[model samples]
Target chain A: MDHGQIEATNLIDRYLTNRATPEECARFEEHFLDCPDCLSRLESTRGLIDGLKQQPPDTFQRRTWVGFMGWIAAAAVTTFAIFRPPPATPPPVTIPGPTLTARAGPVFTLATVRGAQADAPIVTVSGEFTLALDFEPAPGIKGFAVQVTSGTGEQLMSEVEHPLSASGTIGIGLRSQDLKPGLYRAVVVGKSVDGRELQRVIFPFRFQVP
Target chain B: MQSSGTGQSFASPRRSRQDLVSAIVSGDRSAEAELVDWFARGLAIILSRIVKDHQTVEDLRQDSFRIAIERLRSGALRDPDALPGFMAMIARNVAIEHLRQRTPGALSATAPDPTGGPSQYHDLARKQNAAIVRKILNELPQPRDRELLYRFYIADEEKETICERFGLSALHFNRVLHRARERFRELFEKRRSGGGIVPPLDAPDR
Candidate 1:
């Protein structure tokens, strides 16, 4: 191992042994998340801790696995148990014969959207750019349906399943020329099954016709 | 229609941390927004360890970032490289303070506290995790290595003595220990990911 890696291992040892200070542990975390080599090394260090605990008191009872086969088996067992795969999404609800699908909840609720806005957060916009509306859905909201309208309530653009960026903002490609360069509002409506509105949010912004 | 109002600026995702610090200090609105967007997730992870409530976590994240920006403006941080860790420490302090404010005496059982002595939930895994550790330990190649690990870990032996017992210099011992750890991790991850394992680098000669 290189000098840096050795140092990282030492820090890992200190961390696992409960000897690392808050600052040291914090530094270690920042490094490990970005360093694959360090992560693999830490994995082995973790194994040492685990393997030591399974030691039997009697030397005779200290059974050794035959060759590398036993070692491989052990790895399989330990790894599978530690890093279980994420749960599969439930299948879409459908009635057997008629193929009817039913969904609950209101089309959109200001209350629910307000609650989700607290969690996922609503990233507001400024300046002249494509209007983007993104927000976290209240519980059980499957997808979002968004609409943009002018101050006079003229529906300008409507979209379904508009992508929400990692920062949680949805985009509407409305240039200054799209709407006579006036004040406009993007209304994001959250929906569950059956096009039910879970909640709605209005984002108001102004743009000048270029 | 207004042309380039005060709040008018392009939202940019390419701002570097230093750029963010500068922009935030200079009161650039777009830069401030970008700073929040960049640091919020990282802060959320750090704060979530101490503050369980999602609302409280978000609140503390914002508060920490705000404090960090203010500190930067005041020239508190000299090195830009320490930004990530510094930000994390700020978030941690904020969480700790929040806990103190809410419970008065009940500190979070998951982090470091002034009083100390296992008040934090850190490393307090349940029995299942312990069992997993034990299962992995049984696969180690050398019983001596296993013994060495046990003494150092459970028995809490001093490094000086462990090196002496192993008949190696401190530096060499550290290397051996590193290799041992790496080998163990290879086995562990291979097993966890449900992949077939290859030969062990340090498998004991039976």
Candidate 2:
């Protein structure tokens, strides 16, 4: 039940993977309840195993293929539309005013790492941009709670129970005009159905308006 | 015994288990909350492993806490040092009882249904988690190491078999796992403090 025993037996991983005996399970659970370090390790190991379970063989390649096909299909449709013969009685073409395009500003995929180092990722954007926050959702989490704040502690956005996309990434659209160019952090918390906070990830980045 | 890779010691100064038990027996509401807060996550992790149904796991967790508190208040616990083991036992009993009820021809009228499917949110979460795992697997320096993890964790292959196939000694097997887990922990640290972030995908080369 001690930490040594737990490590020697890989008890945390075994317990999570359901490979432990009943006695081992009991001993490890009891030990972890009293040992915060073990408890945290148990949680992290559980997350890792649960995540691995969700992935089938070739999951990444399959998803990448699907994404690639989607882009190809979109491009084909665009090409067909552009090259198609003009309609016999086309309506008068009207010029549109200056407005935002369907696609937002530069899309930046922000990587959430261990901490804020001197070379923290920097995103140079103008007008509005999209921040893609990638995270490993814990098993059984129902929704994610996200909060964005400036380095100075100014709250920018707060959301509870935000629905996650199928890609395991959530895109946050922010206007560069509203944010001053310093440091900003986004905290994404995965919550269970009962609103329990299961896992949390922090993404820190510097915003530069060019 | 060593501190976790996160470098934050969870064994910081806190009320002893004996103090917690005595406070609870003395009708301290804060003590009750503290006890629940301390053990709730661990209990849930334990119970969820036994019970597949999310709702049932939740119900059993609450029931375990209630029963433990009741016993504590009634002077049932003999040794304050045995609090963790005692709570774990209570949770296991609750989960087992629920499982027994779920057995064919054993379910009572009041027994909660066990046939419910995972919610949509659960499915999405699984997909998201799978994506992250894929990223981690790709980051591994060796494909063989990735395969080792996949076989051990996802394939549920036996450790002995995996080690034999990989030609790794028992110590080496443990080392691979320990290293992978440490890397996983390093990337997965919650509320990480100051560190350098990777540049955006499209950022110009420095």
Model number with the top DockQ: 2
Residue-by-residue lDDT tens digits, candidate 2, A1-210: 457878888887777655676677777776777667776676556556666545543432322233333334555675874454433332221212211111111334443321123224444443444565543333455567878899999999877346532224456657666888899887888776678876666677776544
Q: Judge candidate 2 at residue B160 and give its lDDT.
A: 88
Scored by lDDT, model 1 comes in at 0.47
* Predicted structure with the largest lDDT when compared to the true one: 2
Cα DockQ of the candidate 1 complex = 0.08
Candidate 1 per-residue C-alpha lDDT over A99-203 given as tens digits, one digit per residue, 9 for 90 to 100: 111110000111121222221111221111233342332333445677778778888886645321112334444333356656656677666556786566665
TM-score of chain A of 2: 0.46
Q: lDDT of each prediction vs. the true structure?
A: 0.47, 0.59
Q: Each model's TM-score? A: 0.36, 0.55
Considering the two chains of model 2, state its CAPRI-style docking category. incorrect
Model 2, C-alpha of A75: deviation from truth (Å) = 45
